[model samples]
Target: MRFLVFSLAFCAIFTYCLANRPKHDVSEDNYLELVREIEDEIAKENELKHEAREKDNLEQAREENGQEKAIVGNYDEPPYTDKEISYLQLAREVSDQYMEEIRRENEESENVGARTASDSLRAFSHPSRRTQMLAEENERQDAELETLQMLASGENLRMRNLPDLTAKTVQDDPTCNTKLDCEGKNLNLVDGKEFRTITGTCNNKLNYTWGMAGAQHRRLLPNAYNDGKWKIRKLSVTSRPRKKVFLPSARKISNVVHKTTKPKPENEDSISLGLFYFMQFIDHDLAKTAEGHVRKKKICCKTPTKATKFCLPIVVEESDDQFDKDDCMESRRSFVVYRCNDNVRNQINEITSYLDASMVYGSSEEEEDTLRTKKAGLLKMSTEDFLPISERATSLPCNATDVSTCYEAGDTRANVHPGLLTYHTVFAREHNRIAKELRKVNSGWSDERLYQETRKIVGGEIQHIVYTHMLPVLIQDSVLDQHGVTKEYDYKDSVDASMTAAFSMVYRYHNLMPHKLNLGRLKGDGVETFEQFNQESVFQKPSFVTRDNYDGINEVTLGMIQSQCPYVNRFMNAAARDLLFLDKNGNSFDLVALNIMRGRDWGTPSYTAYRALCGLGIATTWNDLTNTTDQEDIDKMKEVYADVQDVDLWTGVMTEKKLAGSISGATQSCLLAMHFANIKHGDRFWYEGSFSEDQLEEIKKITLARVLCDTLEDITLMRENVFRTNSDWKRCSDIEGKIDFSKWQE
Candidate 1:
């Protein structure tokens, strides 16, 4: 029963198992088959889900694309800040997309081990491919960030260095017609504008600045204002009278002379009297005009004799029938000789009689006596009278002498007869006397001493030139405003006036002499230190600072020296005297003032506008904290720190090196100066920090006596071989030699 029953049960059980379990293996095969079926179903479901997802992704992509297009279309109208935010958001999205792509690729690489592999699986596993893409992405983002940083920095710099802030501000003068007032509704400050909303004030004197008013005052207006259409309007102004001011005790001496004086004529034998020759080369216009005049006047000249003939001729007629030829000739000769007064006739008659009586066929006592008497009579007469006049009476046809000293000749033309040379000589003498007088008024120097001193160095010719040319430059610059011809503080006009004065003075004196007036030539050999050869040269000896000071303030001094001049950097051949003023020993005091004044407008100590006021000697009031900064005694210090935060040059004081007190005080002074004078940095003086370190060093070296005083040729020869040679070569060949990088993939 067990066998039979077990067989039946076994059969049943086996059949049941066969029906329930996998038939082929009932173990690994069956389980695998089931697993494969389930996998197939799951795959089918997954495929459907993937298709749905793909459709969703396409819709999302389309929506995203539409949004991107809209954003791009409206990009021009969007606010810059909004645009920046949008770009930042796009960058974040891109980063997120890249990170997600990396994760997906990693996941795919892991999944590839369990599934049938494809070429894409290998590509997804390649670390170098992802690395390259990531590197490119990171590089692009880095560049964008760097560009943004640069833009931000540039904007901040632009704000910090407003190019025309001073120009925009109204001059703080009550007399200014464009001055703003907070009275009534004349100004926007009183009208409660969007730019300004002053609710109340004590007679408008203490009104609050708001909106545009505050923005402008604070220099918060962006660079966009550079292109705006705006007009300045005046609400109120003062009618105050202006006062005249004179140059300080420190008068800047000019090299050119200013005035002239004419000397009185003397007799032929006067010891002081001498012939003066003045030469002039006419300008194109004048020469052409003179030439035209000559042509119009029908003036003619012949060679050899080269005699000039005037249009109005003096004629002589001869008639042969009137008298015998010899007799007529004798009568004509007699007429020529005796056509004079009784005194001249008697003198001639006696002179001829003595000569005739003195002549003898042979030696005799009576003839010798007669000859001795005639010689004695000739000796009593003036040398001029005894001598025969030559045909070429005038050395220069145009030259004129004292009429009383010359036998009157009819050859001199009336128009051009008073020679240009003579006129100029007279002009020069007169000019020198006037210039000397002008100099004495303020210089406290004696005229004769000046004349003697001047004479020893430059001849009377050059002295005359100085008076005619150089003196007017100083006078017109110094005194013209007092004479109601101009005004003080008008810099362009002032510079123009000064230069014109200089030019005119140069022109007049230059015309007074025969030699050409070359300013460059005048500066030949430069100025020397010793007084032994102290002549009309412009350069003075160098006033060098102590070696200790030189080392300590090396950078500052160099910058100051170079900044004052423009040519010291670009042109190596600039004259030594021109490095500063006429003097070689640069004016240290003026240099310091210039340094301070230059800072009034730019960089760390920009006080250009301030110095303009101070330069004008205007009284000003500022906050006590600021004003007290200048009180420090800095005579001992050499280094002047131009800190970014400070507005004044702070002398390096051992006790207060950290404090910026001097800066504040100096800034106040400069600001006050600017408000008063309306001076610009480039106009009044050179600012430090304008030059690079290398340029400054080069310029400061100019102060060295040996460097500047040396000839340019010598300097050129010495420095001819010195240069910066770049020797390093780039690895361009290796980089170019690399094969196509993608070839490895093939």
Candidate 2:
């Protein structure tokens, strides 16, 4: 009691001294920091009093019960040590101080209003000035890719003016750029024409292959590793001791963080199942990383005693809810890229990184040649106007009788699920439809001209759908405008269009899938059920998509539009949580576990690194994760992870509370915004830039609803926003923004 009084007296004296000190003579940071320490001491004193009262209550309860037993059902957090209490105090101070900083800064904005929480979107207020700064920054900094290449060649490099970049190019025997590019073999010269190459090269004039197919994915932060080199980050990166902390087993983290006993709730946003799968489709189009040298199958589990470096199987402990005690989940590391003698490992992205419909048309010339018939500029169609049946021997993976159901597209992942196949089918049909329309106006055009023009149009329509229809559903419109993703972009070659590893980690949004895969049609509030399949059965099986005389396509299309997505939460659906990728022996891998392991396998940084990068401050303790989610989630995360920094990006971001007016959390939203913004501003062939104002308008008119209308023979009527369930249904003819191809006349 006396110590408390003396502490109060000390605080009074300290406050007086600081207040009387002139503002010009004192540092705001130092002042706030000292004030924070005083507040922390007060908080500690209060906690002591609270604990004394709780002890008294516990003693009274024990006396009344006639027992001296310890308290049960106490799920309270562990008592903090002195150091921990200090950290907790800093966390408490951060909230009010951070908010004040943002509010004060926001008031100085040119075109902004008052808002609480965060004033992060203020960067958009002066975009021209911002862009100039970015351009100037790029000019001053050497390209990271160049730096990596130079380090690979064992050359000493100063920050500025290194030797010719071409001297350090990888020893590729083929597929090199001509004299036009800064790097690449002087072998191929691709012209910048009306159409883009199947290979995502020549997108940048000064540096060809910046967004090229088969290039290495860019790293947003330096890769974290156990050995601080090629080894996966199986341990915490924290140099300071936090009570013998290490990264827990991925499976353990999964079972705890994603432990949901309640029935998984539907998305409150009412995002349709179609949009959920469309996210996967976008992933397939953008990044198709090459399969690892080692396969992710029975090899790792079978050879656990002598497992190679390439085989990092996920551990399943005795306490596992699903797997047997002895079983381990089969896993494989991504094929390591050849980055010379550098210890820092990197992975390869085998396809184009652009949001181009590489999923539909193929990213490489070889894949394009296989997909195209070179006849009338139309992609081949099978009987009943379905996607062409695959001729490749390995394409059909189902039972022999199900061969009839197998079909092909530019991306082989079309065989993975009905949603991807449905999307592939629609785009293939849309391509043929557009080619036929082009032939109507310009009969003199050759197959090459027709194919190129149609391809360009289809690609433009895709970019429009992703930016206009899909992104708005995922991110806020205000956010879109803030990030300049929705703005008219002038192509900037200075920007590196390569995707970051962080972006890839964010794309694993598998929790959005509902456990029961509904395949049916909806008429008003009623339903016309066709078939229902579980998650495991539909994978690698095409029969589900080709059933009922090919009515399955239409049924599944409607199923996607009508069914609601599972809400974005920590809960992994039972099917994904336990039944993912079942093998003949009844053993299966957990998707949630795989997501965590994969982030580590790729050497991606922990959640705190990305948070700091995205302007979400680095957390020193789990309590410091106040900006992330509710305390319940933080408690769950803290239970799994030993230290806050040990949490993987996939697990951390997935558990975050959704940002206001957005489906994703703040850090993820920022990273995604950065990605789309780069692709839009950096792409030489971004639709708005390549097309005339009239042609661009026609492109903008193409929405996802219009795409469905053109492709789905059975979809006579669909909701205006095909991605939204609450939208009004209308006949195909009544849908607005139908494409006008007359503007395409050259």
Q: TM-score for each prediction? A: 0.14, 0.74
lDDT of each: 0.21, 0.67
Off by over 4 Å in 2: 1-192, 238-245, 295-298, 393-401, 522-527
- lDDT value, residue 194 of candidate 1: 15
Off by over 4 Å in 1: 1-89, 92-604, 607-609, 616-632, 640-746
**Model 1 local distance difference test score:** 0.21
Per-residue lDDT tens digits for candidate 2, residues 1-746, read 12221233234324444654322222434543454455455446656665555455444533432233424223353433332333323322332233333345434432211111011111101111222232222211212223222232322323122222112212221233234543444322223244676778777767776787766778888878666666788776554455544688888888889867654889888788989888888888887553342211226667766665456677787566687676677666664443534535566666788888898987777778878889889898888888777764232233224355667677756766788788888998999999999888878777888888888899999998898788887776766787789878878899888877888889777878788778877576434556678876665555566778878888888888878888878788877788765545566667888788888888888898898887888788887788777899999988877778888998888888888767888778878888889989989888888788888888888888888988887777777887888887788888877777778765
Candidate 1 residue lDDT tens string, 1-746: 11222222223323433554444333432432433343343334445544445344434532432221322233444322322332233223333443444455444434211121111111211211212343334323333333333333433422221111111111111111234465555432211311111111111222222111001111111111111211111111121236323111100101011011221122112111011111121110010000000111121211212211111111112212111211111000000011112111100010100001011100122212221222111111112121112132221121222222221111111112122212222222322332343344425434433332222211222222222322232232223223322223222313111111011111221111111111111112221112111111211111011113322112212212111111100011112111212122221111112222211211111122223323422223222222222323221111222221122321111111111211112323233222212211112211122223443333232211112112111111111101101111112221111112121111
Shift in Å, residue 43, candidate 1: 28
